[model samples]
Target chain A: MRFSEGTHRLHWATAPLRAFVFLIVYFVLLGFPLLLTQTDDGVRLELSAEVAVRFLLVTVPMTAIAVGSGLWAWLALRFRIDGDDLVVETGLLRKRRRSIPISRVQAIDLVRPLVTRVFALAEVRVELAGGEQSEIALRYLGRRSAQQLRAELLARAAGLPGHTPEAPERHLWRVPFGALLGSLVLRLPVLGAALLFFASLVFLVMYAEGGMLAVAVPVLLGLIRAVIAPMVMYANFTVATSPDGIRLRYGLLETRMQTLPPGRVQAVSIVEPMIWKAIGWARVEVTVAGYAGERQALSSTLLPVAPRHVALHLVSQVFPGTHIDAVPLLPASSKAVSVDRADGAGTDDVVFVSRHGWPCRRTDVIAHARAQSVRLTANPLQRLLGLATVHVDAPPGPVQVAASDRDLGEARAIVESTARRAQAARRAGGDPTHWAAR
Target chain B: MAAPPVYRADQAFAPGNGLRWSPNSKRHTWHRLLAAALWAVPVGAVGEFIVWRNGGGPVAAAMWIVAVVLGVVLAGTVAELDRRSLGYAERAEDLIVMHGVFVKRLIVVPYGRMQFVDVTAGLLERWMGIATVRMHTAAAATDATIPGLPAAEAAHLRDRLAQKGEERSMGL
Candidate 1:
């Protein structure tokens, strides 16, 4: 379908779905009192005078207003692709017209929440490179249209002409469900919560008390967030690569497909938690420019959990042709023993890598061309120890590249060398615009 | 004592690299003092009021006097140190900003990575004829600020930096 031809409205399903979502709590609350009226004769449809009045005066009108407004908003909402921008017009009384430049498009994500998924609809979120208010979402598009639109937007952003077929993705890896579950359970918080949960359960059984129930509830909630939520989110997590960039597909209840175009990733970090270290498991995260908002949590995650070698291999793939092992690592100076015992930093022709953190060892890798700035900092204690920290700045995200508590001289050297490397890399860097075209 | 180790002169970020660092305007000192006073006066007044209302007699007044004197002395010293510490240098490919006393920092932001340059002056700063020049890169953590330049200088620096940024524009 030609997106630039004319304006288009959202799917008709949007009206009812939006109304249902808005009144879900109201529906539940109304159903609850009805359920309480159940008896041996079965739930009677007898409504009390007060509830019946409320149903007529409040619930009926509220539902009508919700459905009416949803339908109105749907009617008012119209989006079309202009010459080089996606123009969205919405609202009736207070109209809003937003035109997002295709050139500044960072990443386009397709999200399918459970409700939307049930209706075979999806939400298309377009991320632009700027501050907080940089995301634009077009909700309740048909799943197929959402996918096609995402591909089209990506192709345009990559400076491809016409409706180019998406570059064929080569499957790289998929996180096994068992491994994901195991990894989540092995986490410190999850393990602690599990222990507390069992202890509380034992206490509740040993002595029938309400106090232990409170502890049990919170512990169970923590366990759910730490384990079950991630299990559902990262279920069937898959990674792939193509000429356009890297693609990630994951989620069970709410599916998400994120595409990171070439050269967009500012930095990558490999993390190995203490328990995961024993099992030789690791997680990889990256810092992408323009992902500084709510979507940052999942978008930054390159790999949720994988074997050590797989994580390293993925890192190498993220920044092609660079090998982590090939770069000679320099151990932190002995003078920094007080601050960091087992930490080191290294650099190669293409990337600067720093390994730090005690229980959870994190190795941050920033491509020379991607480095925005380099910093050398020293506190009084560090000054006394003749130690300083060299920090490589990228856009705001999870990946922090810092070589902390190094000898002052080494820190200074790192800063100078990194800056020079960044300058040289910038000179040779590929055109940021029209990435695929180049 | 033995002579200090002679590091390479080409180290751009080295503290003693002989770069011609431009200090903030002299009026910045007064501006900082006034700003500090603006904060301290109200805070100190509230604190003194709380102490007096609690029914402590002359002791509260004496304590406040000591506190005020100590605060002024500390603020004055800090203001001087801060004035001495803040410096920025425009180099061949990047701008370097150095500041802080107890915790010294030197940040080098490449011109090519700068998204924009912002020049701002608060009411107090405008009154004092001083402004701040902030160089923003795509990276939010790039803390490149020249906080106390004369108004004209700040504008000049902002324009020059903006021009350089455009010339060396490397999109993120």
Candidate 2:
């Protein structure tokens, strides 16, 4: 449990197996040319044996050297936490060393691939504030040790006590199995596959061609894969807010533990898919500056599935002044500008809100000060209908939030005023040095 | 509250062109000319060799000569136009960069939003005594790169941008 102690090596048993796997993959790739020569011509087939002998003559000694180096690397690779820094040293000949300040650590993730999972081992990836190249990884630790180190590293990075008295782990929400699986299978992919399968069946009946099997089988396989992957990845999805920060633990096969500190999240969005909307469900996602370097598909997800109200509450946790509830914001009319309405929708300065949807209702809001830029668009159909979409952009993040189908005049006014408000807010709060005093 | 500023797409924010300066005209022209020759020489040689080997007759050989001439002319013209269109302005809190020939693009990067500023020079640029200044923000789309500035000017811009970025990026 003492992470700050002297030095530690990875699980020793996995080293030899990892080295063997690496060699196997290397040989398979190298032997491909020989295989191709044997298939192409008989004269070349004789030369293939000579090539194989020459290859072994060179690679056998090379493999021996590599194995020797691998053993040395296993013995030499060591890590320690000294003061506020995590120091890792490896390589016998080149002798590489890396020291990462805990303060600069943005995220600590635990990944267990299929092979590693069988052995009950995990790999810890530490991402620093510096872009992608700044990542440091420690591979093949026992599952329990990996989890403990992830927590310790995250707490240290966020400048919080590793074990706080008041910091009890509070379970906020866990996605239900039915809802999670429903969200995955109810997407356009299944519908598309169904339509394609029907068309292929009709074509096969008409022409009696064997090509239909080629198309239908692959399409069916892809549909099955798409459904199963997310279902497995989000099987035990859960989110919570601890003193250290927002802690997320999910995945059935390859489990991951992620911590996102306050203020590190640049922007957040609450997305309710068409299918999920009918059931009053939503997903919350965020964008973090540190992890933006390498785009991980599902890294910034705050909540996989939650009720609309619960998702909104989580949004408020990250972005203090924002909410998704219906307030006395401006309401735009269909025909002419409506200043007469008690709650002026086509007016400026009250609140930025856009409401749309028929079977499902969608409302979007962005505080004036937090908006990076505001854009107004009116397609030909919308232009004819006198409606437009207002897109409020914040700093670059994983998720984007926009309000579609509003009165054109109101949309224009809202975007212009929002931009002005953003400029004024930046000017006023130009100095936050005193406020952020640690 | 007063009325907010309304933006019109056609009317861009006009920067102070009088205060802006272009790269050294003579040196830039030579740089583009040399680059065009570098591209033209290899293609011309290959084309001439292919035509000779194929016995494509004198007309085909003449066509290769014309193609090489056209390629050199097109590269040189585009480079000249690109050099003319590129410009940069330094405001109190932001840097504005504008460039493009057919479709104009204007980028405004606030000093507070700047994550880092870098100055780099490739081999040709170094030989020409020029460098490129790149300003990076947390948003990948907001990056602004200005090439063909004197090495000294590029360095000065880098230092000033770093200073302002540090001073302004105090909060978030």
Candidate 3:
């Protein structure tokens, strides 16, 4: 279907612009009448005219500044893609124009708020590999339009293809939800933020706004986000598989839909927060060519929620040679050493509590890192307890699936030993291609 | 017919040619720093002139002028270092960059990965006989640039890289 061809227009996305115009109108019409009113004094107030004129003078420039600023911003973000180049024509006064050839286009990512998503629209980001030049977005397109744009743009970069689609040759693994939420919330600075907001409100009430108003403002905003947190979260995240790429959709206000092909992914990590340990949840992230450490946005996440056991199967599908599901799990009778050292809790025996802690649930889980590079991390207390978290980094990037609190030298050794076996098996013609071979 | 393997200056020709010889690369370090310093001077002059004329005394004027000069000199020096430090690698498929200090990095981004690459020669860069090489990925997340590439080499590299990507992707 033919649709409007472009990013979110400046006039359309700048919501506050109309209000600014209204403010100018309001100041002139209403404030003018108020400022220039004849005083009750018998003498007609001459300054009334002056006051009205001054206000008018101030309003005109303020109005101009508001509208001008938005316009300038729009000018700074003028983007259009031509057959030859993905052109970024941005400037305030100088007219800075940049053209990125389509051949160089590597990936296109989408981002925006759920409101945009609710409208079935999002921002389309254009990226080239190795960081030459790329465009952040061609926004306000409906999902279909955005996808079409992305596909066409990518096809342009891919060049008229006579060759087959060249996605990576492997299935994708998904993480568990319980694990995702646990890690997300645990990492969230909610407590500190709540405390700070509380203090700010108190200060505002006690020192500035006084009493009810100050208290009301902070509490009101806080309560709203608290309520919104789960609701936004519910509609927040979704990841999917597409060709040789992974598509991730996330965000509350700024909804982001990103795609990372296997070629782009540099590393992959799976994190299970304390919360997921109870029900068994996990979150998976990848590292890509352009995207580096910490910001997992560059990579794809397998699952926001899943069962601990099911994780292996999902992983096996996504990343070849990463099939924990195919690998055998050992029971307690097996001689894998306990690596966990929680407080008085020792690795010899793990205490699995059903509930109550921010990660909120508890269970002892240990997965050996796929052996590529050896990494050992220890917290101050873990060190005191003579324990350190160790993971064997795997290629692609390191995959640290599980960790123990204390030093699990023996456990690490055993897992490495098993990893060797897994590696051997992979090398010995375990054709994962059997499942999804092109 | 097998396509003549397309190449960017960074990726074309030399085995270790990619180790440093990027196509179309000249050097932008001096020009950018010069521009910044030139821009800063007028700003500092204005501020100092204002204070001096406003009766803050010659000391304030002198101080402002000194500050502006120092800032420009320091910034220019730093830019020079950055320009001198960069090296490029070119191969048939991709442009490899071994750039940066304190954080020595090797970036091997395939032509397929490049969203687009721009070979630019501004007035000052033109005067210096240099060009800027910039490339992007589809994601638009990380942008890589080789500033101050020799203009002649840059045009050739840009054309070659662009041509290569076009043959493969059908994009600009």
C-alpha TM-scores of all predictions: 0.91, 0.71, 0.44
> In candidate 2, what are the lDDT values of residues A113-216, reduced to their tens digit?
77787778888888665456767878878888887777666666655554322234677888889888877766555767878987998898899988899988
Highest DockQ among the candidates is held by which one? 1
Highest lDDT: which candidate? 1
DockQ of each: 0.47, 0.13, 0.02
Rank candidates by TM-score, best first: 1, 2, 3
Candidate 3 wrong stretches, greater than 4 Å: A1-220, A223-229, A232-269, A277-279, A284-302, A324-438, B1-30, B56-60, B101-104, B164-172
Model 1's C-alpha root-mean-square deviation from the true structure amounts to 4.0
| Clash list (residue pairs), candidate 2 | A330-A345, A331-A345
Residue-wise lDDT of candidate 1 within A1-438, one digit each (tens)? Answer: 767778888888999987887677766776445434455897666667865775667677779877997789789899988877899998878889999888787777889998788889999888888888898888989988887788778788788864887789999999988899899999786787899899999999998877999999988988888888889988999999887788999999899998888887889999998999999999999888878777688688889999999888888877877998788889887877553354889998799998988778888999999998998888898877878889999888998888888877667777878888888888887556677776
CAPRI classification of candidate 1: acceptable
Proportion of native contacts found in each model? 0.62, 0.15, 0.00
Output the lDDT of residue A381, model 3. Answer: 52
lDDT of 3 by residue, A136-249 (tens): 556455566566656555544444331233343233443344544444454335455556667867777677856646555766577556545643543446656666356666
